[model samples]
Target: MSEEIKVQLTATPGEKPDSQKLGFGKYFTDHMFVMDYHKDKGWHDPRIVPYAPIVMDPAAMVFHYGQAVFEGMKAYLTDSGKVLLFRPDQNMQRLNCSNDRLGIPEIDGDFVIHAIKTLIEIDKSWIPTEKGTSLYIRPFIIATEPCLGVRSSYTYQLIVILSPVGAYYSGGLEPVKINVESDYTRAVRGGIGFAKAAGNYAASIKAQENAKKDGFSQVLWLDAIEKKYIEEVGSMNIFFKIGGKVITPAINGSILKGVTRSSVIALLQEWGVPVEERKLSIDEIFEASQQGLLEEVFGTGTAAVISPVGELHWKEHTMKINEGKIGELSQKLYDTITGLQSGNLPDTRNWTITF
Candidate 1:
C-alpha cells in the first residue's frame, strides 16, 4: 500500500440505501479517493475524503477544453462472503492510455488499484450483495489548470469514486433493440475515439438521446469517414455471430479498447471458438441477416457486462436477430463471465483480483 494516501474518516455516516432496489450510479458511498497533479510538483498528495461536491475554478481547462479521461471498473461481493475486483489493473492501465492520448499526466496504476481496495475495505458495507449487484468504481482525471487557452493544461486531478449499483440495463439479461446512429459520428481515424475521454461520450449524447426517444436502448456508431464500417456501440463494444463464427469491430483508432472485450476474446479462443476481430461493416451484417446467416448479437463492457442485442434498426430497415431473444452463446457467455466475477465458476485465467 502507498503511504502517501492520507485518510480522513467521516464523523457522521449516511444511511445506507436498500441493496435490493439499488439502481446504477444513483447512490454513493461515504468516502472517495483523490490525488492532484501539477507541472511543478508532478502527481502527489493522494488522500481519501468524504464524498462531496468538488470546488474548482470556473476557468478550469477541463471546463473549457474538456481535457479529461476516465475508466470504469467494478468490485463484486462473492457468494462466499469475499470481495473481488475484476481486471482493475487493466482498467487503470487503460486510464493511463487515455491520459497519454489527452496530454494529461499519468497516475500510478498499481497505487490507484491499491487505494481502491483500501477504500472498499473501509466502506465494505456499501457493497451491494443482491444477485447481479456490485460496487461500480469510476476512476477519472480532469484538467484543473485554470486557463481558457486551447492548449493542454499542466495541472490535473485524479479522482476515484464508488457507487453501489444494480444491473446496468433495466431489463437485465433481456435482449435490447439498438439503433445504428446515422446523424452524428463518434470518432474517425486519427481522432480521440480510442480513449475513454469525455469528449467522445459528449459527442454521442445526441444520438443516444435520439435513440432513446425512438425507444431503442442504445446507439451503435459507425466509422466517421466510410460511414458504413462499424465502430462501436455508444457504451459498449459490440459483437456478432454469423455463419458459425464470432466477429467484432476491429480495434481501429476509432474504437475504445475494452477490457471485457479482451477477456471475452480470450475465453472464446481458450475454448477453441472461432472468434475474429476485423472490420465487419453494417452492410455485410445486414446482408448476413438477409441471407439468414446472422445468428446472435451482443455487447461487452464494464457496466452492462454482456448485453444481448435482439433487434438492430438500420436506415429504414429493422433486422431481428436470433428470433428477437437472447442467443445460446449470449447466455453462456454472460453466465460464465458473471460466474467468474462472483467466484461461482472456475477462474482459470486469474482475471479476478480478490481483496
Candidate 2:
C-alpha cells in the first residue's frame, strides 16, 4: 500500500524507431508501469520496470474466464517541446468502470495517473514529435489468480505500456470504408458492452475480420437483440451529420463511452453546432443518404482522434458520405483537436495536461 512508485531504469535502452514509419502500437518503449492487487494485500508495489512479457500461470482466470479490461490513450509531444496528455483522467475513470463490471478491484484513479506521469517522465524521449505522431498509452488490468473456477480472481495485475505511434489509420484523416455488420452482434444491454473489457474485443474480432475481408476498414456494429439500431464502430464511437445536425447513438449500457467522442461533443456544443444523442437506425441513415441529408459520417477514439467515413455498405446498398471526402466539420474537428493536443491551439477548455 505504499504510495511511492519505485523506478527501475533500463540499462540497455531499445533503439528508437524512425518517426515517419512509427505505426500504431508497433514499437514499445524501454520501460512500463505495473501494479498488483490481491484481496488481502490490495493494490501494492507500484513500480516501473523494463518492458517485457508478463509471466502468468497457465490456469490463470484471465485466460479461461476472460476477466481482463484495458484502456487506450495517448501522450503528445507538442511542438513547444512539452509533453501533453489529453483527458487522461477520464480514461482512468472509465478504467474503474470497466473494473467494476469485470469484478476487479478499483485502484485509486488519481494515484494511477500520478504513476502514469512518472512512467512518461522516465520515457519522455519515446514520445514522438512528428506531426500526426504521438506516444500511445495502453493501461490494462488482467486477472492473474491461478484458479479456473467461474468467479472473479483474487489477484490481478495492472500494467501500463507506452508505444510511439504514428496515425492509427494509414490514410491519416482520409475517409475510410465501413461495413454494417448484421450477422453478428458486438454486445447487448446488461452485458460488458459498456466496459472496455477484453471479452468485448474478443467477441468483435470475428466481425471485424469479416469486414476487412470485404474491403472495409472497420465494422459498424448493431445492437445484439434486434440488430437494427446503430451501436458503434468497432474501435470508435460513431457520429452522423444529417441536415447540418449531428447525431450519435445515445450511451445505453452497450456502447463504450469514448474519451475522444465526449471531447468532440463538447467542441461541437461550444461552437453552437447542433448535436443529439439518441437511438439511430441504419435504415434512417441510408434513407438520409438517399435524400442527400446524410452530410457527413465519422468515428472518434483515442487512436484516430477523428476518422472520416467515406462509404458504408449495408446489405446490398452502399451509402457514400460526403462524396467520399472528409467533411468540413470533420476536417475542422480533426484540426482543432490535434491543434489542442499538440499545443498549437489555446487550451480554452483545459482538456490537456502538460509536463
- lDDT tens digits by residue: candidate 2, 1-355: 4479989999999999998899879999999999999899999999999999999999999989999999998899877778898988899899999999999999898898888899999999999887788999999999999987899999999999999998766666789999999899889999999999999989999989988898999999998887889999977999999999999999999999999999999999999999999999998999999999999999998888889999999999999998899999999999999999888999989789999
C-alpha lDDT values of all predictions: 0.90, 0.92
Model 1: per-residue lDDT, tens digit, 102-171?
A: 9998787899988898889988889888788989998889999888879989899888899999877556
| Candidate topping TM-score | 2
Residue pairs with clashing backbones, model 2: none
Off by over 4 Å in 1: 1-3
TM-score of model number 2: 0.98
Angstrom error at residue 29, model 2: 0.4
